[model samples]
Target chain A: MITKFRGLVVAGAVALALSQPVMAENVEVDPWEGFNRAMFNFNDGLDTYALKPVTKGYKAVMPDMAEEGVHNFFENLADIGTLINNLLQGKFENAGKDFARVSFNSTFGLAGFIDVASPMGIEKHEEDFGQTFGYWGASSGPYVVLPFFGPTTVRDGIGMYPDTLVDPVYHLDDTGARNALYLTRVIDTRAQLLASEKLISGDKYTFIRDAYLQKREFDIADGDVENYDESNF
Target chain B: MLNIIEGEMLMKKSLIALAVAGALTAPMVAQADATLYGSFRVALMSADDQDLDLRDESTRIGIKGDVDLGLEGTKGLFHWEGQLETTDSDAYDAGTGTFAARLAYLGATGDWGTALAGRQYHPHYLWVNIPTDIFNTATSDAGEWAQLGNNQHKRQDNTLAYLTPVMGGFQAALGLVIAGSGDDADDDVDGYNVAAKYSANGLYLAASYGDVDAIDRETWGVAATYDIDALKLVARYEEQENAGVEDEATEVGAIYNFGEGLSAKLRYSNLELNGNDGDQWAAEVEQKLGKGRVYVGYFDYDSDAEALAAKYVDRLAIGYRVDF
Candidate 1:
């Protein structure tokens, strides 16, 4: 019985691996976009309730230094992000875009580096390991809410490895500060997205749901209009 | 005879398992022929008070492959690697044996990026292993990675890693190393590391940070190399801190190719370990000969002079290395 069970386990793993190719080929719109929309709202809540006040408090303590550090940290972190995106896409030239993002965002975006996406004319692209897994044809397993990382799927959860591997902040040496900074980045990003609420009409859940799916579609295509297949997405 | 039959059965089962794993991973990187490859080295040396004789480098091999799953062109990846050392080798003697370095895992890729799970490299030492002799040295190897006190598993078990798609030469990766230790004290014992790198022509730059539990460690380095015909120049700097002690290390080197299976290189590296106020310098040169390479290296410690010298530690070594 034990031998049979062991054999079954191995067989199951192999079957699962083999089936992935087929599963990925049949693309379907994820209904869980609504669920993710809720996360967006929750993330917005944290930004409004927690991050904003904290930033204000920190600013009160040492406004200039804190603001400068925050600005530098974001630029450095964004550079890291841009570099990783370039490596994954095999576009060396586009990677240089981060420096442009950092320079203009710091100088013109007002110390807040506030949503420099529009003024600098750099389109915001959101991607995580899950999307990469999707590109690689990995089935988007069930959605999950990581304790701290927010909304994720099994495939994306796994993709996190190489994601952070290419993130500079991940390699920082200060534990407390690193955690605070990481949490802050997530919160700040969420806060920035809060403004998009103005763009959406109708149920909050539907608005975010449509937005996330549409945004994911754009990111996976690497912003290439030729790669865009709206019908399938 | 029954015992022999049982052993044979076990061997067959293991082989079958390995074959299945290979098939699953073959498709992921099948396009680039870009494989996942790394090596592990472990050794034991008995340094004499006068001669300072060291031990040979222990080594292991790894290979990885990626396959594009047809579903939306998502991909699957698998890697198998392990250390080959006395303790973990099949030829282990009767006394003591232990597991050292061995990593195996499977993962998938999609529009979001890539994800992986199982035993794998930690982001903490990613950049540290990129340059110089710091990682491969027989004296003070990069194995100090696990020594950092905190909640990080360094190279961990039951891990999940994610990588973002590269956009305009930029990308990011994040990992959550799960500590299976059920104890409450170890609950926060998870390890996380992230890194980002940019490469264009000869200029390559990267920075990374890794946190294992509460102890945060980082490596921020910049390296640039330029090749003009047969000659090339290389320079790099790395900074690291553990338990609040900081070490700043830098390396500069150059290599020249002399046609027909021949090349030469000379490089210097300095490490100031944790404000002990002591600094160490290592210089090395290598010449290619046929399928093998001959190398000469010198290591010197400027701080603990008499004590270090008495150990016959500061000296030069000439050796040969060949890769298969």
Candidate 2:
């Protein structure tokens, strides 16, 4: 079953990749707007009815220090992906910094509970397979909303498969421990985002879509926003 | 001419390299098709005046997979499960800390339906008995009722089965016991079973019948479950006839989810064996943590028959279970 499902996913991604034009102008990116909206609504309903209440209860019960520790631990684990992606993108200096951050946080920072590397001026780089693919000249393709996973472009959606394979947490031999860590990470992330809901105004879908697209562009360009033509807006 | 020949040679070398890379990566991708899973369960129980005993409550490991048949909408399936004994007791008749095969089966599925062979679960047990078998313990649950006067109610070896594709919330299965060993040592087809189930809108209903020629027993059961939000209610009724003796059982159960990984389960069963009356009830509270659970349960059994009273006892158990 797993094999068949994955085969379908890979086949679909290849089909989508072939159908899309190479490096088309970044206008009308959301050609599948109808499908995206329906999926977005489905995800929003699930979060509102199920995940939100559970996260609320988790936040109410967990101590602040413990929550922060959990969040930092996952973030520290995420550096492994960032380091590998940086190397893939030919960002050797950033990859070195990422390595140092992981080393310092895992040891002196007590498994990343303390931001010792940040204070030491070691930068944190957010890089993933999606950004790596973008750096290698893969078009972002049409926007899509995945079930449970939320927003992504067609290229980024395919990139997620490789990212999961490289993720340290996904490689944990103990399934119970892995699942516990995953659940904790999700709850911690939701808890962090709870306060940010107030910042969203107007059409929630459009606001999130625009923010996500811009962020992807910024990450792909390595924060050199000046490369984008002013007239493109 | 020399440059073209060198280019062709280089192309051949790169093609060989690509084939080698594909060979190396193919198995890694195929690994996703098969799943390795296990559940480790240990419990501490105190029954009546017995000392505190640590027990392995059905700890097991298994691997299951689906292999694409290279045909449209068809796949081959296989599963092998084994019990892992964790305690110093001969609970499974295999000595302490021994491995015992629980289920081993091979099957095929397609858009048409599914067909399975080898040792597998009884259709009666899957469709009828499971609705009320919510407790996490091996000894205390609705399974006891299904086992009365019929040992083959749970699973049987040398079995062949066919299941129909579900159509509008309904499906059906037929199973035949081709041969068996030990208590069921029949040289030919000794039993046949049929089950049907319907599920929709949080409600499930099922019924099954099994006729075992080796034991001269015929058993039948019906079960139903209705779910409302976080609350689920289940009920089952079973009857067995063997050598002019009749046994009957009725069970009712409920499980309430309190959200945030907490739930409570309660079950009550009434039994009649050869005109002797017995009743049992169990309750448990479980807290789910990741892919594991910690639970505490209490159960009591009372019987009018001396033999039954001697066999069944009151007990309280605490168990921890983790599944992968």
Candidate 3:
């Protein structure tokens, strides 16, 4: 069974590699618009009625320094994934920086609560299997709004499995601790994005969709976006 | 004996291989909200006046999923679990030795409520007995004995259940076991159970009542738990009356986490049946590994009745369990 599954994975990767070239121009591909909108509405309702209030309460009780520390700790753990993706994308320098960030922060930063790597001039890079797939010319198919998971492309949705494997919290032995960490990470992420809500203008859905697409493009292109329009936002 | 050992080893290896394969292939099939999970638990137990033996502790594999029905807010859900027999025992010798069905149910849920059909866990087991079922080994747990006394009030076949959506930390479930299905084919309605629970701020309280018509048994139970930091306290009381023979059980337990994947559990239970009394207690320490744990425990049971005394003996157990 293991061998058969590995063969399937290899075949799938090869098929993805040999598929149609990336559709660079068509970023707003929403073939499942109706389904996506419904899911988006469901997610929005959950966020508004449940998650947002809980996150607000979390933020109100947590000190700013503590919140930052928690955020940095999760970021430090995430660097392990960034390092793997960097290596997969053949960006050895960035992979080395990611390794350095994790090592330094985990040790000198007191388990990443302090983020000493940034002070030491180590750069932090955001990389995932989705970006690696895009780097290898895989097309980001139709935009999808997953329930509770929010927005993603088909390619990125598939990427989530590999990312989950690399997640440190996912490997935690204690179920309670792992779940608490997952909840804390979600609240921290939402708290960080609370300030960015002001930047959204026009239709909230459209704005979020366009911004996510643009951001994916920028990340896939390593921030060297071609024909980027500053006035779009 | 060698063949049995070899078979068990092969099964263990195959299970590990299957888990790895599933983990690898999960990404390609990540379309729906589905999970494939399993737990493999075994214990080496030494009982008074008996030889040490390796035993299976309710090892099970299951798949559960929720699918968006595309309705306004409803989703379809299904769960199926089956126990894998690992020990060399005659208790499961009948054609069901290899694997036995534990839970198989289908349901739909929305804002209004949830309804399910098929064989599933009894509310009496979940809400009432679970508070004190903390031991790693299933054999020595007080909850296990309580269920045994009540004709194994765990899962019932041909059950149709409805659950009310939680409101203000309170939820209620009603289940009806239909006759002319599976085991209870001769009766009109086999049984019915109702359970209610309230959980908030580290405190949980649950109550349940069940009636089995074929056996003419009526059972009721209440359970409560409180959690503070690394410590949890649990207690439960249950009573059953069958053919004018009344049985009562009370259990209390505590769990304390020492951090760093180490924890301690202590539990005590007393059961009074047919004017006879039995007492059981256990203490265990567990060390958690990745998705697994290794534990050692001491259990003692004493009873005034000879039948009960012969069944529930003092034992020391060392166990390992892993879930995926």
**RMSD of each predicted structure:** 31.3, 22.6, 26.6
Say which candidate scores most in lDDT. 3
The global Cα lDDT (0 to 1) of model 2 is 0.81
- How would you class the docking of model 2? incorrect
Q: Write the per-residue lDDT of candidate 2 for residues A1-233, one digit (tens) a residue.
A: 99999999999999888767533433368888789999999999999999899999998898988888888888898899999999998886577567656765765577788766666556688999999999999999999999888999999999999999988989999999999988888888889989988888999988788778888999999878876765787
Q: Which 10 consecutive residues of model 3 chain B have the lowest summed lDDT? A: B140-149
C-alpha lDDT of residue B200 in model 1: 59
Q: After superposition, how far is residue B96 of candidate 2 from its true place, in Å?
A: 9.0
TM-score for candidate 1: 0.42
Model 1 chain B weakest 10-residue run by lDDT: B142-151
